[model samples]
Target: MGEIMGNFRRAINNTSLSRFRFYFQAASFLLLIYGGYLALNLGDQLPTFACIFSEPRGGSCYLFGLQHQMTTPWTSYLSGRGIGLLVGFLTFIAFFIVFNKAWCGFACPLGTIQDWLTALRARFKIRYANYAEPTFQRLKKIKYILLALLILIPMAIGNSFFGLPKLNHDFGVPFCMICPGRTILPLFSGDFSQLALDLSSKSKMILTALGLMVTGIFLSGSFIKKRFFCLFCPMSAFHYIFANAALLRLSKDAGKCSRCGNCYRACDVGIRAIADDLQHKNIVKDDCMLCGKCVEMCPEEGCLQVKFLGLPIYQSTAEGFFKRMQGRNNAK
Candidate 1:
């Protein structure tokens, strides 16, 4: 078993998995949007933000997006129908633990789109922006705030419907109302209907405008910054709250580390805690999407590793780093 594991780690570390991860992202993007029609043949859709749409979503139980998964199930508390909420919540947990934040890294259509934008910027040789340490630290709090609002607004709105059926038409799923993913992901399917302004009510108009504005910022910001929206993604906050349950993790070898800045520079989210915190061995941070960019870039043998169920699948090595760089230069 030890020999087999050692060989697996060596095989993984020799080649950059991020390059192959793109294949998974592209395939998942296709599957999420069109898999049901394309004969995936699953009885129910795997739960995801985009799968909660009305007619077009592929998921088994289509609620009002991920927000519905968060709210409607809890509504049983106020009303008498707790079963849907309880079942849906369990489904969410089941899908969540399989890979945890790896969803953000590998499968999320929004995150994939942002990565494509980063690639486009790189192709043009345009410099990407990185937040300074202090600014980045402060920005980390935004996701938590968004997470709170997403849950609170839905709970309030779900309850209000029982008490006052005519509350804000757009109140039930407040985060989805303004989530850029709602307006952005459907465009690939040749659906622009989501972009239409909701002028039904004064509340709807406000909600529509807010969603558009956030989408606009998302477009421009993602072009200039890597995973720009992820800095404030409520979904990311949700994942980290249950991160401990994930079997896969990023582990650090403090003694093997050399304080090299390459890992920090390579990180898309600008998480500096990877370098500064030598006190802890398991170095998963809340801001970390578990993308493994640091492990790919680090030039220290076994200094950083991608561990699956407490076993190493990949690790950093100086020789491997230089060999890949040299290969790239020669190809150029």
Candidate 2:
């Protein structure tokens, strides 16, 4: 028992956890696309940034339909009966609290695709862009705006919520009409049908054109910058609002930190706050997906760590960090 405990302690003491996340991302992405839903039925839950407006109204199904079952319950809840809504939300929360935004890190199909794009850029030695603070802060607002619109447009569709001004019924699932997920995610599943524009209705034609445009921007932006679409993901906004129950989180030991800024440089989202915030112990920023990149890059002992329910899983150490960093630099 002593030997077993010793080994487990040593294992948990090690840093450099990003490789595990990459493997998990690959496995989870495949499992989801191939019909694996955590029995919570949210196996298809939209990423942390999937539109919440999509929640009550339904019809914003992603490729592979992972969250379609999830949508049905919520949609029914909106109409009348509350049982499905209560059960669905509870069931989702039960599993969701375990990992929080980790769904963005290890399971989102579009995020996985962005990882592929980053890898492709790396393979070609292509330079990727990182935004400056001012621009990044400005870009951050876009998602909140998108989130608001995602809600308002769908609510408008229902039109008669206790006698409120109604938007057009033709605008059903408005966000879906322009979601890049609607246009791009389908291509991977051998569904080219989304590419066709329905000239049948003005709404259809306009939305189809918008989808194509957004899809183009998504592809180009992803190729140019890591996790580009994620910066504006309304789903991410939703997660931030209710993520207090999440068990998996990132924390920092300011006393042990060297202020190296390596974590910020390593972060895919370009959040400088991780390096700038010298006071807060909970280093997990709003933009942080708990992807472990910051933890992996941190070079100071116990400076950064990923914790599950407040227990440390792994912690930063100079030896492990330098070994991993050197290997990565050499690979470049």
Candidate 3:
């Protein structure tokens, strides 16, 4: 049994992470997109985009619930309604703590779609685009701004703020009003109603137009830039707020790293901290999806790792690195 276990570990360590992730993402994509046919409802507080717009979805995004919860009357906090909000928040935290940002990297239907586009681009021999350092630094903050708006706008709709008039009800769920996921994810399940422009109200018309425009950008941008939408995802920002409390984590052993730049190149979201941060042991940055790509690509033994509850689940190994390289060479 001991020998068998060792061999199994060796096999996993040497396998192609990209190939493994492709199959995993495919399964997750199906489960999230079509699992409702099996009556598999994970719930409405999932950290990832199990879009409600996609009928019979396995789950719903937490943002959808949060935005609505924020619309409750300010005085309701003293009533039983407040308990429901607390329970909902606790539930979201429970879900988020288990997998951490792996929800974004592994299970998000939208993220999987972006990955498929990236693969398609690769197949066509097209070069991918990258943000300039200055631009990346600036753009990454957009998610936080979006997160702030999603929270404050809903509150404003419920009650006046700073002596200002209450926002129009048509601005309901402001973030969702413009989210591209509502426009795109439904198409997988044969629903195209989101494609139409809403003329019922002026606000709806403007929101629908913006939603359509974002959907166009989502499709085109994701094709050219890996995980393009992730840079500005409010959900990503939300996850980062509680990242330190998650059980699953990415950590680095700076002492073991030779800094050959392999891990940085492997990062889909272009997180520079994974490669350059030598001072901190915990390396899961806000933009990191906990995708495990950095660990898989590192050539230095024990340099990078994915840990669950402080125990290493997967880590870089020189032997594994060499074996993977050999396998790639054989394939060619």
Candidate 4:
């Protein structure tokens, strides 16, 4: 028991954990640049699946290709607008269960933008207020309300009580109009052409607000900590609902935990996994973006790992089998 306890203590004091956090942050930035480039060049649109839009004849609008086809079918089905919404809901559920918010951390074009802005803000030594506390938690709900409005208002108007077939027609692609990801693509491509007719004054205001929000997030992350915009993203609301059952989880061994709070401080999501009760050893909180920073920062050996399907999937350090065998023999 004494030997086992000593090894556990040694693991907790390990220093490589901090280096891993640096690497994870670097990788996320590289992915953002690549995704942003794809969004800008219109390379994200595949030619084979272009018939799903109202204006299929006008070459291939970036909105027509990805966001419209993917999110709409799901949103429509969820809103009871069509049978396809069921498919969308199921697919989203599957993704949530398997990988949690991996999409937001890695693949989301908008997330990439926010991350880049945060990086820039950090480099320039800017400052913004930290909105990560309980007071700002309610602000996170705005996305869900917006999502509800996006789906509900269209369904109500499309039912024809308002005599608005044109409104219904527009509803098929409404999310694209306000999507920050789609908007940023046009800005990067050096084409203000799409901005002239498509964006309304309200949308322009929203865009302006989003720009300011990005700036604030950047400044906050630079002066405060990384991943500031994650607090208010609607996509995260969806992820929050499904995170509890996610197949991949960050696990911590309580016996090895030294209670130094370094992992909590390193975590941008504010999950204090080390301080939590032992029964729920998994930090399966909705706020966790699965960036693996906590796992990387954990000083305890075998105390922190990324687990999948009830088995350990990733470990920061590797010890030879002979060493493990020797340790086990000595323990006996």
Provide the RMSD of all predictions against the true structure, rounded to 1 decimal. Answer: 3.2, 4.8, 1.2, 9.5
Sorted on TM-score, best first, the list reads: 3, 1, 2, 4
Output the worst ten-in-a-row residue range by lDDT, candidate 4.
47-56
lDDT of candidates 1 onward, in order? 0.76, 0.69, 0.89, 0.51
Where does model 1 exceed 4 Å of error? 1-8, 41-51, 54-66, 69-75, 78-80, 160-167
How close is every model to the real structure, measured as TM-score?
Answer: 0.89, 0.84, 0.97, 0.61
lDDT of 3 by residue, 92-183 (tens): 99999999999999988889999999989998999999998789999999999999999998899889999999988777688887888899
**lDDT of candidate 1 over 220-306, digit per residue (tens):** 999999999999987788778878888888889899887877888888989887887789888888778778888888889989988
Better of 3 and 4 by lDDT: 3
Clash count list over all predictions = 3, 7, 0, 5
Clashing pairs in 1: 45-59, 45-60, 73-85
Better of 2 and 4 by lDDT: 2
Return the top candidate by TM-score. Answer: 3
Task: Compute the lDDT of residue 30 as modeled in candidate 1.
Answer: 78
RMSD of candidate 4 to true structure, Å? 9.5
Ranking by lDDT: 3, 1, 2, 4
Count: clashes, candidate 4 = 5
Tell me, by lDDT, which candidate is best: 3
Q: CA shift at 165, candidate 4, in angstroms?
A: 13
Error of 4 at 203 (Å): 8.0
